[model samples]
Target: MSRILVVEDNIGIRNVLEKTLKMKGYDVFSVGTGENAVRLFTSDIFDLVITDLRLPKMDGLEVLKKVKKISSTTIVIIMTAYGTIENAIEAMKSGAYDYILKPFSLEEIEIKVEKALSQQRISNENIILKEEIKSRFGWITGKSQKAQKVYKFIKKVSDRPTPVLILGESGTGKELVAREIHENSSRRNFPFVAVNCAALAEGVLESELFGHERGAFTGAHAQKKGRFEIADKGTLFLDEIGDLPLNTQVKLLRFLQEKSFERVGGTNTLKVDARIIAATNKDLKEAIKNKSFREDLFYRLNVITMTLPPLRERREDIPELIDHFWSRYTKELHKDMAITPEVKDILYSYDWPGNIRELENAIERIIVLSEDKVVSIDDLPMELREGISDIIPKALPDNIGFTERVEYFERDIIKQALEKCSYNQIKTSERLKLNRGTLQYKMKKYNLYCKKISTKS
Candidate 1:
């Protein structure tokens, strides 16, 4: 239930408000002085506060300011008489939700209270949605010290308007962090435009960043707005910012210094209120020393810096990340699959050079190729099996039960033959010296299949 506090020096008005609010199913608290209202507010949490503009101990505006200082999300409504309408307007300017003039009907009070609460509900829902987005985008992952530090820094700097430079190796989820920040900020409702600075040539990248006019270049057919214009009141993410040329860096620095730019081949200057987030895998400090990156531009973009640790540095998070991706791909591919302990040992032990992206791809490959409901050592790629075998001991321990030992031996034999025959079931059966029917039965019994992986290079 929503709680409301009514502060009016007039005893009759206070009683009327308390009775009407209670009849409307609200938990209403009535006070006759502004001092009492502040004291109660400091002690409790109220969703809304309705106060008269005139009070004996303190004024309504003072109460509003004090309550706002306590919590900006608290809703304040000002009540004024006929001659003090100016004071009510001032209250509104000072962060009041709405004003109710004297002699208001019960219906009017109800309508204003309902409207204010409705807005508060919408605001709360938006905050929850943003948090869900952050979790889904990989920001809220693992409890390692490094991961916790990153999360703390992200939360601390998300609401600020400074430019953030994400420095990490490729595939370390730099862009994910950038998107998380944008989603958590006030500008989340607007567009999030991204540009790959290393993919395009200098001329094309310039045109892409600042827009182009018709006949500006060979392929220019119409006037276009660049990422800056498109990301106005939102965020513009420049990936591989280290690959940006000197000339393009100058233009970007100018735009960062002043949120104004002109389209390519256009004379008119355009202004936009966009936040800049740049990411790169290169050593920008070294680049600066080599004179390939501008020192001034680096300082401007480096107002806030975030460095993501490599996967090898945070191996403790690998198992959790694998589980996360497994849940995702199993649902996406419409498969019910389970991985063996050996497979987990292998995945957890390997050094992921490509970080989270590579781990996700590895899981996706198994999901696509394995026909069985359970994943085994044979389902993994050759490198992972070899790496695991080299690292793990071969002897079966006394802790292993009989059925598990048999299953392990059978899975190991099948995986070896599959690796020898290049994952071809027909060739593997011929090499194993078993009938095709028997091979098929064993494969089904052991949850094994020789499906090949298909993906773009």
Candidate 2:
């Protein structure tokens, strides 16, 4: 149930508010002073706070400020008497959700509280959705040496104003890296705008980047701020930068060099302080060799470069990635399922040609389509199960050294499991019947870092 705290100096008002809120099926806590209200807020998880504007010793505005400091997400509603309109408005400015005037009907307060709680619920849901979307990328799921190296690189360059170019294969989480850089950087407070160069045609891409003045093109009816302008004092991410046309590249290069540009068919030059972050699945050197990409532009963006390793290389991270996905999707899909050892063996044995993205899709498919809570071999797609058998040889030579062969097999199996789970140690240990400490030791011994699992272009 939603928790609401009622803070009023008057005993009668506090009792009435608490009783009314309790009748509405909310968990209510009542306090007779602002100090006691703050104490309750710190001691418990409250969804909403109703405070009287004129409290003895401390006022509602102070309570709102303190509550915000404690939990920025908590909603605060101010209660004031009819001639205290100025104080109520001041409360709103100080982060109050809404104000209730004295002599208010219980029904009116109920409706207001309901609306405030509903809004808070929506806000919380949005935060969860964003975290879910962010976690879908493989780069966010590991602490392996390779992942740590990449993390350190991101941290080092995130503060710099230089352009960053992330090179990674499809589904290798280039965007995730871009976001991490932005989030850790000084520009984090501002918008982190993203554009896909390969997704848009040259003409449209040009307009999208530089925007256009009114009547600049057939459909340009009014002035439009480009991505750079919209992302001023923030980070602008250009995905698939290798596909940008030469003409657009020239324009982009100029923007990078001068930090200013003119809109299409417009004379006024606008300056933007947006940090540039670009990503591409294609090799820029090859693109430059083919004369498809400009050398100067490549050099500009490559100031700080980070490459993501493919899933095949970092097979050790799969098990962790899979477990992370399972934990997330189990809650999302409302299923309490466990991945079986046999199924894990199958996953580790197979070669993931499609990488981390493909593995996540396969897991989601099993979670949704499986009839039982336990995901067995039968739950997997036929191709994956078949591929596993083909990849693991059916016979072993008697002449071969047993210890050496077993060690090799164990290493390979562990590597694949890690890759399947996305380098999550808890999941990897669960899959391998080992503790987290043992798994960490084995990963170190094998020289396996999570970054090896997903290929960065």
Candidate 3:
């Protein structure tokens, strides 16, 4: 149920509002002064506040500001007489939800109250949804102190319209950070366009950025709008900015300065408003020294910089990351799988050079290959196996039976073939020159037969 506080200096009006709202199923409290309303607010939480514009001790605008300070999400409606309508407007400017004339009917009050409550409900749902999304992202990215700092910095600069340069190694989620900034910004409703600068040649990259007119090139058949034009009033993420060609760099600098650019072979200088976010794994300063990347362009793009630390530096997050990826893959593959402590030990010890992407791949592989519920150390890849071998005993004791040794050998071969073929039994058996049924039998014997690979990508 919604709780409402009604503040009116007139005793009769306050009693009437309190009785009317109470009849409408709202827990209503009435106070004749803003000071008492504030005192009541301190003692109890309220969803809505209805206050008169002119009060005895404190005015409605002051009450509105004070209520917002106490709880910014609380809905406030200002009640004003004919002469005090201007004061009600001022209250609205100070964060009042809506203004109701003093002589309004019960029906008008009910409508305004219902609408305000609906808006508050919608706002609360949005906040909850955003928190869920942030929590999921935090789980996947490993919320280490370094990661938290990066998140804090992103929040600090998300609303600014300055250029942001993100530096991180490959697979360090630079583009993810860029998208996060865009999603949190004022222009989130606009499109977000991303272009891989290293993936295109000079001419193609230029055409992609600034568009081209019909007959501009050999294969040009129709006019085209480039990323800048497409991303107008939005954000354009340029990944691997260090690899951008010198000529394209000069053109980009001009566009950033003037917010305008001419299409290839077109005389018209089209203007657009676009926020540019650039990412690079290369040291751009060193590239400047090598005369490959332009210094002026670098400075123009480097107004705001954020760097992502490699995963090795945040090893403290490894266990949580492992659990996160394990749960994800298990859900995706529709399998009930668990990782053994020995496997976790090896995973924690090994340095993840490919970072989160690599760790996710490793988890997916384990999920796709492990038939039984538990993932053992034998299910790991060769590099991890070798790394684990160094920390444990290498030779088998003589007391161990031949059957156990054969089981270990069979498990190792199955894991190797699965790794090679990416857990496709047909391919693995074909490469092993064994019958598919025989391979399945062996895999079952060693508990390596995971769920069949889904045909859907």
lDDT against the true structure, per candidate, is 0.88, 0.87, 0.86
Best by lDDT: 1
* Preferred candidate (lDDT higher): 2 or 3: 2
Which residue pairs clash within candidate 1? none
Model 3, 36-148: lDDT tens digits are: 98998988899999999899879888899999999999999999999888788788788998999869898899999999999999998898666444533333366688888
> Using Cα atoms with residue i matched to residue i, what is each candidate's TM-score against the true structure?
0.59, 0.68, 0.57
What is the full ranking by TM-score, best candidate first? 2, 1, 3
lDDT of 2: 0.87
Show how many residue pairs clash in every candidate, following the order shown: 0, 38, 0
RMSD of 2: 9.6
Give the worst 10-residue stretch by lDDT in candidate 1.
Answer: 130-139
lDDT of 1 at 55: 95
Best candidate (score: TM-score): 2
TM-score of 2: 0.68
lDDT tens readout by residue for model 1, 55-168: 986999999999999989999999999999999999999999999998899899999999999999999888866654554435477777888888888788888999999998
